[model samples]
Target: MTELRDVDFFRDPNSVVSPYSYMDDLVQNSPVWIEPNYGVAMVAGYDEALTVMRETETYSAAPMIAGPTPDYGVEFTGDDIDEQLDAVRHRLPFNDQIVAMDPPQHTMRRALIMGLITPKRLKENEDFIWQLTDRQLDVVLPRGGCELVDDYAQPYALLVVADLLGVPEEDHPMLLEKAGVAANGSLTDTTKEPPKKHGGLEHFYEYFTDRVESRRREPKDDVLGRMAHATFPDGTLPEPLEAARIASNLFAAGQETTVRLLATALQIVGDDQGLQQKLRQDRGLIPKFIEEVLRWQGPIKGNMRVARKTTTLGGVHLKAGTQVFVMHGAAGRDPRQFDDPQGFDIERPNVRRHIAFGHGIHTCPGAPLARSEVRVTLERLLDRTSAIRISEAHHGPPDARRYDYLPSYMFRGLTKLHLEFDMEA
Candidate 1:
């Protein structure tokens, strides 16, 4: 473990293991601390993060994948280099995905993909999720315990998203085997040299691409067929590959968000008998509990953004093309935005205002799905189990417990969660 003052958020695994302390140190110093190692302005305050998110013209998402020193593949020396970055956008990682593009294109594509998650579709998906969660528990509950992450959350979330996207039933196994969430640590790896290939949706990209093409050949009235011929708000049709990227991204993101969130929820519920009893008795508290979980420790630790031009935020100057790591987890814990910010309060009066889902146009589209998935899963778990206990064999005793976390600065989640549950009498 490196010194708190010298920790490299990108390179050091320790940062991923226990980032809260490091984040606390960073936010204490300033809302926007310029890391000397990478020259990244770590934006850890809520207000500063909002400025960076809202001022899209001033901070381009083009550098969303900056690994230490992101090579936008071009150089410029001026007050505004927005156009220069745009010209070399193809050379950047995730360039084709909605997360990387700037305005106009981003706005149009966002409008197009927004159709995938209509209120009607979400309601239908939630019904399926409740059934799936029971089916999952049926497999492990009889055994008296399970590793929630792999045994339950992972496959449960995968199938839910598959059903949502109308992925053929037969394809679920292939996705289960191949479409595992690519770890965020591998993306911003500083130890590796430049030009490393990014781990994308893997075969899912090609599979979806072929699905779109087949729909084009013989149209069927399903989600795939509609998306294959879907158009941007301006009536511009997207190519098959372009459309496939959106599908695969949604699939990957939905699974990852649900799995991480479920593990986090269980981790807390397993030990806090008082909290579990509260949630079980007053089931309405589940939504507030989920928001509190997000505020307490979001699935993503933070995300990186870049300055598109010269700008000032939180009273600090940023030059053109400067990279900023927007600390979402830190922002939630900022005392300025949240009173007793570090405390977990399910009844937080303004809990809905938290920026855990991010802000502005780039806010996570799967927020609703993730919330429902967890709420349903937790409700079912509580329904079936009279008591849930953290496996001391795996995690030690309550006061001096040990837990393993995912090794990625971009994602915050327990790697595994072992729970011993007593079946309902």
Candidate 2:
């Protein structure tokens, strides 16, 4: 048996290059097993992951980051855990984000966020998605082939979220750069020492503070205006920092995952011409195809949770404060949950049940927007191209396709996707 220390699941760059095969081995040993490397409990089974997510009281979302909170030079010495946590958060760079909050606070913050992306707003956003898709395709289609990630996916997702948030068109590039850094900085890379504070977070705080204050003074007719004007359930507006936190969180969180999803979806279809044609022939199947792609190759690999109290999961005893990793990618491949789970089947009836967007309260609030982006992307790509194929020069032969995924354990996406497409006459 390979020792846990020998298996650096989250840290080792080479190990993360092809994580699913590694995850398969880990899941086979046990659905919920203690990773000896970090001593964090890893839950890989679909049911087990859901168990952890649904039982929020037993498992807190407070410690969503993989490793110890950076020292931040603040030594918290206190018997009161809440007080200690509060002190710790005050010192951390991005403490006020919703993902790191607990029940009452999380509930309220999520509600405010939900209000900002309301159904009417989403409907309006949906109507504009086609226009956005065409804008990207107009640039890409003129060229014979392009790298999908940089040329299309990243920009499309970033712009969509930017539009949704009412980020001015002029500031999209800068905001995307900052949010990209913040998103990438959040992932733990075991090879390096953790920084006391992420620079991106500080940048976001400053950027969003100005945006929030400006919106407060003169509310525009857009999503930021809604967010700026939004009140807590108690009828009080969020403080400047709190409003900044909400806006920055939305900016950072919404874009990257969706980019990953788009890249993965395009990669799958680009590789399998038959599957690509099937969806192109019948556009109605695009939604189901997207769902299956999410189940089979979702963007998020896993997320972190902490045991709020000593509890038993999958027959393994866990102590309070123990960090738990809910392996969503692994869970999607659990045989108990999906038959022949590795196979991609668009016709699969229960494919939507996969926790690609996660489960429970922390479920991605931007799931609707993400789905719309992907659907529109495919609709446009297929309409514009007669066929799409992986660039053999870049990815090698079909039998031995070469692709590079993001180095981080938390994200699953091709760093680059080179494609050759035939334009529609």
Candidate 3:
């Protein structure tokens, strides 16, 4: 077994920037070892992670983010897990968010969310993706070099999601400002400090409440309008706060993950000229390339699930309420599942099997939209750029490059990607 004291996977600054080296070690030595540092079970094996995800009855998706365990102030020596969960949830700020709920509650809320992003809706939004991509590119095309994350990926993602959610043009700045801060301190951040109530939720709450009220008064033909008047499976409209929570969850969750995906994809292509040229030459490979990127450098590092009952995972006995970190990043490169798992091969078969967007019922609902955004963005980028390369001054040479990833155990993305590209004449 690997020593937990040797590597602080959660709080270590280096883990935020580059965790694959550490993950590779963990997967090899201790696929199911409990890290004494955080006192949480780390599930690193590909099959083990999937088992935890698929068996939702045994694993609860509550407390999707890692933080200090909430104190309900009562010691329960009872067999009723449901009662214990209810008591603990009462203290969590995001208890009502769809991702934090288990069946029955999650079922209805997820239904309402699915109602908003139907195929037709996503297809319609797909058309807007090109326009949005080009508009952002126009801003950076004149400049030969730009920081990809701030100048392009971040704003582009925020705009696309804002447009999809029917956020007004005037409110764009506020949404960006508030959501940017909240995205960093998301449930995935591994700091030991107690999780504070996110301000972005408050921002979205007010914004969506007004929008929902407006839609109720005068309906329109947009996603917000659909969500504003959406009903549960039982034909009852969600409560005002519930409606706001749905919108807020969509807004925050959708943008955060997509931004990371875009930045990571761009960084990969930017750093490898030969691969960039190959992708540029054969546009058909864009989808496959995107899939490989998700497998190799997916934005989500892991997701947390609590054990709902006593269960054995990877031969380790887990009691109810134990937190499990399904290491998606590690699982993608598990040699048992994929041959040459470390290589970034776009043509690799089974690349789509990666759980970057997660798996089972809690799989990200905005995945389709995220995929579309990445595809359109890559297509337009190759169309407009003659050559795209990483800025060596910002990140060092190929032998020793310096890239800083987001400081969160749950997310894997560079904080900034500086690139120099020549626009096609």
Candidate 4:
């Protein structure tokens, strides 16, 4: 009752683990081919994906997290549906949020976040990251084996983002419970009763609103304080709710994505002892490995953009309102972009060029923090562990391994990663 050819990425459970062959076939056919099953134009080519990202005026980002299938509640037509889309945008889910906004609104709101993650701030955060990695490892290393996602990845990533945002130390456990398991867990599991399109971020919204209002009355020398005080380029202060939404997006969304990257990095090393030893010997390759991990198993699988106008992408014509799903996983491995795309080469020279964080203005601002999280975690993990191994009892033998991926259309993350390790005396 299921078919691999003309497969639907969202519906097909089989495609979760082995999507590359299907992705390869798509790229071979055309960069932006509309799926026969679903009319969505799947952008699989590296250059083609970049074209859609760069041409911001021609696409409506409302579909990015709006839904798997977007309906503006109004028809889109003509060579330019910019005005049409704008008129009905509010009707679309979360139209006020950053990822859903267009031009002027997006530009202003995005600057507020970008301003907070300065080089100085990131450097300070690195110290916390190094120490936190050890603290997390301290708990798991003693057990010798642990479900890496629940024990380490989720908590570590949540706290790192909390520290970055200056979230109150006392509130961490509550935030973790709300975000770490319940919110993040439900969000990645699509089978939940209510749709899980960023419900976790709601918990952050209420928390940040109260905090941002407090920061406004009595300013503190901290990241959230700066964010609370940050004004639009026009010098107008953001509404408390508006500021809170942005912070929630940064806090909750940013944390979950990084967790996925961390899980994948650990899985890679756990699966390959040789690679683990290679990394332990040369810590410098950790950066390259992180990039390669991001390229190969990008945290975000697809970013959808609704066509604002009738346009041609790689010679394929798209009608207005068509949701062009940009496949980061596919595009990163496109043969035209990288020499030996499928093969995981940590030393791949042009590796950084992959749009794992995206290519243009809409690129993820938290990318540096994510890269740091992986690098710091890997360094500490390798240093603290005599050896890292995929738990044969849980994942089966390497040759005939079994793993469960999070059942979500938008994200790429392990549902659970079980690992056994040797403690470094």
Give the per-residue lDDT digits (tens) of candidate 1, residues 127-181: 8888888888898899898888878877887788788877877787766656543
Question: Tens digit of lDDT per residue, candidate 4, span 141-253?
Answer: 88888887777887787788888888877888778776635322222332444554555577788888999899999999888789889998889999999998887767645
Could you report the Cα RMSD, in angstroms, for every candidate shown?
Answer: 4.1, 4.5, 3.9, 2.9
Residue pairs in clash, model 4: none
| Candidate that scores best on TM-score | 4
Q: After superposition, how far is residue 247 of candidate 3 from its true place, in Å?
A: 1.4
C-alpha displacement of 257 in model 3, angstroms? 1.3
Candidate 2 structure, TM-score to reference? 0.89
TM-score of each: 0.93, 0.89, 0.92, 0.94
- Please list the residue runs of candidate 3 whose C-alpha ends up more than 4 Å from where it truly belongs after superposition: 1-5, 68-80, 168-174, 177-196
Model 3 residue 128 CA deviation (Å) reads: 1.0
Give the per-residue Cα lDDT of candidate 2 at 201. 59
**In candidate 2, what are the lDDT values of residues 1-425, reduced to their tens digit?**
46543677888787566777766765666899888777788898889999999998788776675353333344433322444555555554345678777788889888888888888888888877889888778888888888888777766776777677777778866765654422222222333534536424565677767877888898786677677788998898888778877766765676778888988888889889899889988999999998998888898888787676678999999876666899999999888878888798999999998999889998989899999999998998899989888999999988999989888777888888898889999
Better of 2 and 3 by TM-score: 3
Model 1 earns a TM-score of 0.93
Q: How many clashes does each candidate structure show, in the order listed?
A: 0, 0, 0, 0
lDDT of 3 by residue, 1-425 (tens): 24443787878887887789878877776778677776678888889999988887888777677442435455434333666876677565467688878888988988888887777877777888899888888888788978877777777777677777777777777776655532222222325544447524777787888889889999998777887889999999987778988877776687778988988898889888899999989999999999999999898999787777877899998877777888999999899888898898999988999998888888998888889999998999899989988899999998889988788988888788888889898
